[model samples]
Target: MTKLLQWLLGVSLLGAVWALVAFDLLELSLPRTYREVAWPIPLYLLVSFGCYSLATVGYRVATFNDCNEAASELHEQIKEAKEDLRKKGLKM
Candidate 1:
């Protein structure tokens, strides 16, 4: 799950970077309305992305050890419970 989250984060970051680059290129080529807000757009996007990236990294790093252990333990417990139920012929 952590690895999946990490992969998702990486993909999101790539998408953000692509958007930033594409918008920058477009703005450079075409002088659209609200030129005043142009400069701030890239900065805002970068800052927003940086904030989210840092939050995800922080969460992952903090839970790095506990997350994996808990997930495995929970899986084992669930498997055991299922086996017990199956032996008892429970509907679940």
Candidate 2:
């Protein structure tokens, strides 16, 4: 399955289970403590996902590679453009 579908399926399953437990819809006779914990579970999941996303972004940025050749080529093009502009009496 696609990543989005997989994620949605997982989330839906978790939410269904959480609803059943938090609301006692199934009459499972779960303890009150369980319900108390289940109430914050969504917030915990959101915070956990946020933390994971931040860590992934930080790791990728830390390991990102620099393109030196492209940088120099861009600099040369800029210089040529500036020269052309100067020739056209566009003082800078």
Candidate 3:
């Protein structure tokens, strides 16, 4: 499946399970400690994911490469365009 749908399904499944346990929807009689722990787990997960995403973006940007040849070629194209424009009686 597409990545968006996959992420949505996974998140929804986790939320359903967390709700079922934290709210004791089935009256399973889980211990107080268990419910207390489950309540904050989603928050912990969200914070950790945020940290991970930040690190990943930082790493990728730090390692990104420069394209000097492409830069020179773009400069040449701009010069050629300017020359053509000048020949066509365009002033700047």
Candidate 4:
């Protein structure tokens, strides 16, 4: 699905940023070690998972707002139609 792809993309981007920062910190704070090479992948995965969760929440919020707006518009149209019918001596 398009939404799945979007979430994957967002997660990848956030994971990349997280990996960069984490690698930089490790490189600066620790001496040369196997962890420097080994840590990034797991770190990326963890960060990506977090990012994906946040993205899903954001997507749901956006979807809910759009649906709410559409419902409001439909209610307004129904009210207008009823008003017009009332003018023509029809009652609901």
Best by lDDT: 3
| Residue 50's lDDT in candidate 1 | 100
* TM-scores for candidates 1 onward, in order: 0.34, 0.62, 0.65, 0.31
Task: Write one digit per residue (lDDT tens) for candidate 2, span 14-90.
Answer: 99999998999999899999999998999998999999999999999999989999999999999999999999999
Candidate 1 residue-wise lDDT, 1-92, digit = tens = 79999999987887676565556645555444445455466678789999999999999998877578889999999999999999999997
Per-candidate clashes come to 0, 0, 0, 0
Tens digits of lDDT, candidate 4, 11-76: 898767656555664455544464466466666767999999999999998877457888999999
Count clashing pairs, candidate 2. Answer: 0
**How well does model 4 score by local distance difference test?**
0.76
Candidate 3 overall lDDT versus native: 0.96
**Prediction 4 TM-score vs. true:** 0.31
Count backbone clashes in candidate 3: 0
Order of all candidates by lDDT, from best down to worst?
3, 2, 1, 4
Which is better, 1 or 3, measured by lDDT?
3
**Please, what is the whole-model Cα lDDT of each candidate in the order they appear?**
0.76, 0.96, 0.96, 0.76
What is the RMSD of candidate 3? Answer: 4.8
Q: What's the lDDT for residue 65 in model 2?
A: 88
